[model samples]
Target: MLCFGFTFLYVPMVLLIVYSFNYSKIVPVWGGWSTRWYTVLFESEEVWAAITLSLKIALMNATFATMLGALAGLALVRFKSFRGRTLFGGMISAPLVMPEVITGLSLLLLFITLGQLIGWPTNRGITTITIAHITFSMAYVAVIIQSRLTGLDQSLEEAAEDLGAKPFRVLIDITLPLLAPGLLAGWLLAFTLSIDDLVIASFVSGPGANTLPMLIYSRVRLGLRPDINAMATIIIIVVAIGVCLAGWLMMRQERQRQRDMQLASGDNIKQD
Candidate 1:
């Protein structure tokens, strides 16, 4: 089942990557192996602009989403008795279950109304798209952070407080360090979501603010473009490298955590 699922999901991407090297403009029909498509991809000014715009928005969205999401997650776990906690939790999570089409349309209408009323965000473009991405990406980030916090041993925090550490210091010296992996994962997820977003970005993006995904979609609508396939291939390579790095980091952290636990247990045994 796992093999089947892996093949089902990756086979198409693998085929697209393979075709990206083909000399033929026709996607399915291969003319021969060549890197001309990649050369074309790198040479296109519009494509480069779109890529830069996408990266900028994704970075901004990831930063804002991770910050807000971490706070929300902390609140959900640490302040369960707070006023309107139920409502707040639901609102924070709404984006996860909500349909993208509805979210996009509503946000578009909202931006239009706000622009007319406040004379702010005077136009929809990179700022608008980044905001939209942050809105939804933060929800996913919150869930990840919340789960990580739930598994953490709260006594470590208590011990820090007992040792004369202020609340803010405890967070910085203890909680945040422990949650680093989760934060990294959440940031990566937010970045991926922001860059890959098409629906919400399309709704909010204005002229001269085309994202990489939007540009690719527009081209593919006419037909398969070899340059787009080459771009996709490049993206796949980068993402794969990122995934490997993240996995390695996580594994290293886990090993360190396990060693710390063993040392603590030995200390307790010695004291007993």
Candidate 2:
């Protein structure tokens, strides 16, 4: 069953990667194995521009989402009793359940209203798209962070406070470091969602603000081409590399944490 599931998921991607090197212009008809489409993709200015724009938006969205989501998570976890806490928590999680079309429509209206009132963001482009991505992406980040905080041992933080550390100092020294894995995971999730988004981006973007997904969708509408296959292959390779790197870092951190715990246990045994 596991092998069947893996095959179901990755077989299409494998086929797409294989056909990216086809010499034929038609996507389905493989003339012969060649790197012609890759060269064409590299030389296309429009594709490159879209790729650049998408990456910029994804990076900004991930960063802002991580920061805001971390703060929200801290608020929900750390502050036990606060006025309107339920309302605030509900708002933070709303985007997760909301439909993308509705979210996009609401944000579009918001930008339009803001423009009319304050004359800010007169045109919707990267700025608007980044904001839109962050809105929905942060919800996922917040959930991850909240779960992480919930499972974390609070004794270390209490000990820090007992040792004369300020609240902020304890957070900086104890909480944030413990939250690093969660933060990294949230950031990567946000980045991937932003890059993969099309519905929200389409609603928020203006002229000449095409993202890679937008460009790909438009091209696919016309017809599939060998270059499109090549682009997908490149994206798959980059994402695979990123996932592997993140996994390695996470494993290394976990090993170090286990070692520290063992050493602490040994010292306690000696003292006893």
Candidate 3:
């Protein structure tokens, strides 16, 4: 089943890449091989602008989501009990399970309401799009952090406290380090979600705010050209690189963790 799934997933992408080099104007066809489409992609100014906009939104969303979500995770996990805890948690994470269209429409309506009432966020462009991305991104971050906190050993924190560290110091020195991987994963997830967003972005985005995915959809609607093929190929390459890099980093961290555990065990044995 896994092999079949891999084949189905990658075959189309492989074909798209192969078609990118086709020397003909029509894409997904064989007509010799050349780098013509890639060159055309580089020369397109609209594509560049769209790509830039997407990157900017992704970076901003990742930053805000990571910081705010980490705080929310701390509150939910450390506070133990509070008034309306369940309600607040549900509200924070509701976006994750909700339909994309509903989420987008709701955000757009909120923006409109706020504009009319408070006269803020005057126009829906980058600001609205960022807010929408952050709204969903925070849920992802919180989930990641919450899972990490669940698996964490409570005694490690107690050990920190016994060593004369304050509660805030324990979090900064012990908890944050242990949870770094989850936090980093959350940031990357937020960035990818922001970059690939289409439905929510389409709803919140105003004039001159089209993202790369939106631009790609508009271009593909007209027809499939070699340039579009090239653009797709570029996106595939970028995503592949990101996945490979993440895998490599995770593997390295795992190996380092194993080594640390072994060393700690050895030290205990020596003391015994």
Candidate 4:
């Protein structure tokens, strides 16, 4: 089953990567294996511009989403009896459950209204796309952070408070550090979502603010091309490398944690 699943998932990608090097302009008709498409892809200014814009929006969206999501998670977890807590929590979770089309439509309407009411965001482009990405991305981040917080030992935070540490100090010294893995995961997820987005970005973006996904989508509609295949292959390679790197770091952190636990156990045994 696992092998079947893997084959089902990866066979198309494998084919895409193989055909990316095809000498022929037609995607299905493989003339011969060549690096011609890769060269063409590299030289394309429009593709490069879209890539640059996507990266910029993803970075901005990820950073802001992580920060805001962290704060929201902390509020939901720490402040147990706050007024309107239910309403706040519902609002935070809304984006996660909302359909992309509906979310995009609502945001588009919102931007139009805001533009008419106040002279802000006169034109929708990078700024609007980033904000739209952040809106949905932070919901995912908040869920990740909230789950991480729920699993954490509250005693450590309380101990810090008892030892004359201020609340902010406790958060800085204890809470945030413990939440590092979650924060990193959330940031990466947000970044990936922002870069991968198409529907929402399309609704919010202006004439010149085409993201890589939007550009790829537009090209696909025209017909498959070798350059597009090469672009996909490059993206696949980059994403695979990032995933492997993140996995390695996580494994290293887990090993270090296990070693610390062993040492702590040894020390306790000696004291006893």
| Predicted candidate 4 versus true structure: per-residue lDDT over 179-211, tens digit per residue | 999999999999999999999999999888899
lDDT of 3 by residue, 190-210 (tens): 998999899999999999888
Instruction: Compute the lDDT for candidate 3.
Output: 0.91
TM-score, every prediction: 0.90, 0.91, 0.91, 0.95
Score residue 149 of candidate 2 by CA lDDT: 98
Candidate 1 C-alpha lDDT tens digits along 83-170: 9999999999999999999999999999999999998789889999999999999999999999999999999999999999999999
* Candidate 3 wrongly placed segments (more than 4 Å): 1-3, 257-272
Provide the lowest-lDDT 10-residue window in model 1. Answer: 78-87
For model 2, where is the 10-residue window of minimal lDDT?
Answer: 21-30
Provide the lDDT at 42 for model 2.
92
Extract clashing residue pairs from model 3: none
Give the better candidate number (3 or 4) by TM-score.
4
All candidates: CA RMSD (Å): 2.6, 2.2, 2.2, 1.6
Q: Rank the candidates by TM-score, best first.
A: 4, 2, 3, 1
State residue 260's C-alpha deviation in candidate 4, in Å: 3.4
lDDT of each: 0.94, 0.95, 0.91, 0.95
By TM-score, is 2 or 4 better? 4
Q: After TM-score superposition, what is the CA distance of residue 173 in candidate 3 from its true location, in Å?
A: 1.9
